[model samples]
Target: MTIQSLGVGSGLALDDLVTQLLSAEREPKEKRLNDKEERIEAEISALGQIKSKLSDFKETVDEMRRDSDINGREPTITHPSEDKDIFTAEASNSALRGSYEIAVTELASGSRIETADAAYTESTDQVLTDGLGSTTMTFKINNTGDSFTVSVTQNMTLAQLREAINNNENNFGVNANIIDTGTATGGAKLVFTSDVTGAGNDLVIVNDGDRAELDSLTTTDSTETATNLSPVKSATNAKATIDGIPVESETNEFENTIQNVSFEATSVSPLDTDGITRVTSTLEIGYDRDGLDKKIRDFVDNYNKIISDIQSLTRYGESDLEEDGALAGDSMLRGISNGLASIVGSSVDSSSLGGLFALGVELNSDGKLEIPTTDFGLGTGDERLEAALEDNFDEIAKLFTDEDQGIAVRLYEMANEYTSYSGLITLRERAAKDDKDQIADDRERFELRMVSYEQILRDRYLNLDQTVARLNQTGSALLAALG
Candidate 1:
């Protein structure tokens, strides 16, 4: 009398009936949850895609809003001859447009000093001849305490002494070498060169120990005066003449000599026909028209890309055969697209040249930016762009970089409103995620309800099953009594 299975005791298809009832109860609610989850997921995905694109657009506009990208200067040099590279020059945005005649007379040189002839008979000769243990010698730059010492042992030869001096860790730019004059009169001479390049900065060696033989290597006395070594070359400054005016620098690079212009003297200019007069090269500073033009074109292209993405995201299907966009009919997306167009088409008051139209950038009928090749009233797009770059180059920077009214500045701020961490798009995405989580909780509750409903249906069928079984037994008993 206990129903082990739904149809076992009743002789009816109760299992199939129970299955149909559960289906009727669960299908509608489950379908609603599934549809909602799919919609929320699509919306979250679309929001993420748009947020990424907007961030990229923001980065591009941020760079365009910088003055360095808009106002740049280009330096052009014309050497006196194609074969000779006399000098190279560079100019900054602050440099004025002008041409100058530059003549490099002399290149800066460091000091060189060599030992006297017959200083040492051979490379194997010991440095400390009079002393037994060792002697230390100090090498210094003239008039400064900057010096390094080399310890010469009794067994240290002229060659080894040169190596020791050259290999010392504290050695400050002094290089040592031996020049064999091939005779005793100019025997193996130890030469020293200093990279210290000013006119008064000279290299000198001093004998720190009381070894008379060490004096052979000393270039200065205890008072740091030049006394022994012969001066091969004196430290000299780089000399140049700009517009027939003289200028000199301790190093080869001359900075700001010509108001915001810096030039490096590579080599002396070629001599003219007279062999005494040095030829001059031309250095010209002008606005970087090409660079500015490219930046303007990039801005137009990038803006158009954003517009295209927005159009795709917010567009509805044209027919029943096509599926609608994920963000179709979204007011927020429409507002973003409209806001972008408004800012781009608006005028900026900070620049005298006005907004993007002055630079030949225009919004087309399709809500995208373009630099048309067609000719209109003032000039063609290329012509207007070229004129702007040539005449109002600095104004172009103001139009895009000014804090109050720059187009790029305003656009960036607008994009930031939607793409920032606590922005509208992020908040919307988080809300969609919350809804999906709620759907999961609903599904769990729905499963629990199905379990309870199944138990109730089984319990109600059990009573009818017992009554039918008892009635069948009584009818059989009455038939037997009549027989």
Candidate 2:
């Protein structure tokens, strides 16, 4: 007899036995795989966290490694009056530390030209005659040779001409508009303004087509020999005097006039009571002490932040009940922390400022950077930092940016070694993932084996069921014959 289910013939609980056996075989192996996978996942998470922190620290160090950012110039202007500003000035790193007296005489201006009185009877008046076909008006700046053309159709109105000039794609800073003077003498007058500012650089509109009807909008005569439009304002250069020495610029801003300093004239300086001599303002160029100080403080903060993150990621739990850190006992974190500390503590040969110590930056008991309050014969951290900024300001840049042994340079290089595309952290993450994949394979194989083991158990139970069923039938037949 064939048994359809386990224990059907024997009336025994073989199904429960098969279930218990499978459970016993699967529980231990599954628990091991689960524990291993959890550890690898934690490792991956910890690696990502440390890599992110290092990248941030590297970016900050990258900026600090540049000398231009550390060595800066501060320009201060003191006008004659408290309310009015005569000019604004900026200085570069190469600017010398000095004071100058500047007086602004004139501000730079652009040219403004307007059409002759009643140039057009109305805004709708035709600019080109019906048989004139088309006219091309060219706008030119005399000194700069910058020019653009406007195409006027034969039936184009004065308003349409203004739109064409303004809408030209090649227009280099020329603006055209019409103003209604509200009378026949000065009817609708078209105005042309040129942004080209300099003495002798005038806006000269040419009647390229030589059409007399378009002469009202042109600066030149029909024969291109004389002026037709009225000059409202002339283009002029900005003028100022430095220390009684006269200077001029095409625009309001004077660049490199004082070596590496540039200043923009806002308005004419105040005149004396006689209205002849102009009052002067004082401009002083000095080292950007406050800016450098802030950068230094920021560097210290960023360094400390990275250190704190590494510490948190690598620390171990003290008690058995507490869980350990994801990266506990990891050597990579220790190496990174130690490497940064070593660079921060080491001295540089390039800068006269020596090292971070010269800037009053110290490593605290917790192995983090700080500006301490304690004084050690030299001065308190704050006092030393202030003195360094006041005295050896420029040398401070070499301490952190020098190519050979700069703190910032070395720190950046070290961080890159660990966080780069194929760096140590990335390799560690890959290896952890590989282990996880291996565990997954092991789990799949174990499941396949469990399936085969269940089949074997069911086959043995089926035989047991058949044997018991045959014996019961034999015993029942024997008892019935005896009765």
Candidate 3:
């Protein structure tokens, strides 16, 4: 049987004493390991916050690098005398500033044709050709004479014929449909329309079968046929004039007709007393000032947010009772903050727009940036940035986007150094994780050693208890012998 405890025979608290001795040695060591682990974990979390802030700041800088980025170009249009509903225009980055007189003479039209009424009296499933030979139908567009052919075999229904024409691989610029007139004699009719809109791009359908049989099914003439299959609409080109110069387009929308400007003619111009169209509308393209200002303001707001975050993380408290931030006194944070400030203050040699200061962006006492409403001793007025842009458009553009010297370019390059896969932030996080793992390993080894040490102390105390019991029994035997 196992003994209850080492102190049972000796009548002393040997187990309690051993536990007290071992705890004295283990508590301090365990606390040290725990403290180290806590510090490493805190560092890892702080680095993650830094990485997130840097990423947001980088996005703002990237916007300044490309022409299509935020506030890159703003184009506006003003019409003097015409209704905007009649026509509308849009301008691209390449559009030049100018005013032009535009007169819409005509709008483009597409070709539409419908078959004669009652083209199919039988059910939709009935064979279209009876027992006769196959019938071949040809379709042409734009009078080019290049045709696509559709063949109808015996036992094919009118519905099947519609599907065959649409599924034909050679068919181009034309589509067919079946329309029901809801009458006994005019049961159903087949219609065809040209996808393209132009003067000559008409849908011409001709059948190579018997004239009477083919005429009952489809029509090729411009006028109404006996089968009721006739042209409902004719193809026509769009006509307009730019500055008294006539221009023709296959569609109502015209692109690149006058530099980078594109316009769509939605309605015909009002006519004069002589039955000729004479109305003209003025088209103007210019820079959008409000849009550019909004972009600049957004950049300032984002920069300020980053600055506030860094400052909070690295600030030292004023008193002992005040707690310090997780990353207080961190050298990495200091380096990043200084580097961004330097880039913003440095001037670019490629443009007259020196730096952010010249652009009306100033750092406040709190280390955050702001766009001031009034001039900061700069000769330019309260709206200095806007004035600069209006006067020196090219120089302002170069200041933000120059190849190697631009402020935006330099900031982007610095951000990549901290956020890349092999960046300093990534390496620091990895090192902290390794230190935490080592502390865990040490704690496990210490616990195992404590278990062995406790067992050794119990064995030594058990031997001492046995020796004291024997001595007590010997004393009792001597007292009885003397009595």
Q: For every model shown, what is its TM-score relative to the native structure?
A: 0.81, 0.93, 0.81
What stretches of model 3 exceed 4 Å from their correct place? 79-84, 103-105, 117-127, 132-153, 163-175, 181-187, 203-234, 264-282, 374-376, 379-382, 460-483
At residue 450, candidate 3 shows an lDDT of 90
lDDT of 3 by residue, 365-462 (tens): 77677767764467433367777667765566567788788877888889889988999888988888998899889988999999988888777887
Per-residue error at 262 for model 1, in Å? 1.0
Question: Tens digits of per-residue lDDT for model 1 on 136-187?
Answer: 8888875555689998888689999999999999988889999888996898
For model 2, how does the per-residue alpha-carbon lDDT over 1-483 read when each residue is reduced to its tens digit? 667788888889999999999999899989999999999999999899889988998998898888877889999999999999999999989899999999999999889998888768888988888595887888888678798988888889989989888999989889989889999888998888988888888788888877878777788854668777756898999999999999999999999999899999999999988889999999999999999899999999989998998888788889998778888877889989899999999988877878888888999989899988888898888888999999998788888889989888899999899999999999998999999999989999998999999999998888888889999989999999999
Q: lDDT of candidate 2? A: 0.89
RMSD of each: 4.2, 2.3, 4.7
> Cα miss at 466, model 2 (Å)?
3.4
Worst window of 10 by summed lDDT in candidate 2: 221-230
